[model samples]
Target: MKKSLLIIALAISIISCNKETQTTEAAAFKTAYIDTSKLMEEYTEAKDVAAKYKSKSDEAARKLEVQEANFKSDANYFQKNAQANGQAWAQQKGAELQQRQQQLQYAAQTMAQQLQEGHAVEMDTLVKSVKKFIKDYGKEKGYDYVYGTGDAASVLYAKDSYDITDEVVKLLNDKYTTSAKKEETTETKKEEKK
Candidate 1:
């Protein structure tokens, strides 16, 4: 009777232990990480944003360059004719050139600041979009945690198998392409209507 009771108790404990193990396994958290630098580099939307800003910067630079060239030409003309134009005229013209220079400088500074602010706003929007996308992806994929690794890496090390950067980038690009196509189609339809 004693041996049988001992056997029954052992069996009960074994069953309980097995049940606990199974529960623990089932409750294990699923985690993954992304290489943000790679994601940004590969993401089509990010690249497009960068290209758009670059184009804007280039255009602004070209405008400034033209203005600068004109200013230089005017200054050269003034210098060449300063003495021949007489002291009073030279001083007046010199003041005018100085005013022009100040205006040019102000314009350049304003343009640069506007571009910088616009770029910053766009980048902030892009980052927020990406973060929200990642959050939604994590929930959809049953990921308990999705860490980021980049210039300001939150994750120090993760196995390559656990990296989802490529997957995220691919999905983001596909979404962007689909949206872009839809926009183009909508525009084309509007144009046709016209």
Candidate 2:
């Protein structure tokens, strides 16, 4: 009888220990997604500026294309009329045309380089801001691991329910809003003091 009781006690102890461990693990861990795309879209000023620069560059390219077409038409007209007028005048005009083309090319190249440089600067600044936010978020929230989709090897196929993108955005908006309110109050106090 005592032997049977001992076996049952040992089994209960093992089962209870396992249950405790499982409970502790369950309480300690959770999986979630940050949906970085949403955050970048929402808070990224650099991305916005880069987009503007790209639009401007595209516009400049289109304008240059129109100018090139006009130049081609003018060149054709000049070539057709060159036989009637002195080749000297046409030659002079051709040299002038070449100068104009060189100037346009230089301008286009400069604008393109400007766009590229601006985009690089904006992206670098954005990356720094995002990294700082993520680092602070991890520290503030006690996240064991905060992974981004940029890591293609992992973090694939997370369900929408597990995503905390909206939550994080909302939290940030609230924090900023509250800070703005506090600043406004401080400004009002200063005005009163004055």
C-alpha lDDT values of all predictions: 0.94, 0.77
Provide TM-scores for the models.
Answer: 0.87, 0.62
lDDT of 2 at 88: 94
Q: What root-mean-square deviation over C-alphas does model 2 reach?
A: 6.3
Positional deviation of 25 in candidate 1, in angstroms? 6.5
What tens digits encode model 2's per-residue C-alpha lDDT throughout 4-32? Answer: 99999999999999999999988787566
Off by over 4 Å in 1: 1-27
lDDT of 1 by residue, 27-114 (tens): 6979999999999899999899889989999999999899899999999999999999999999999999999999999999998899
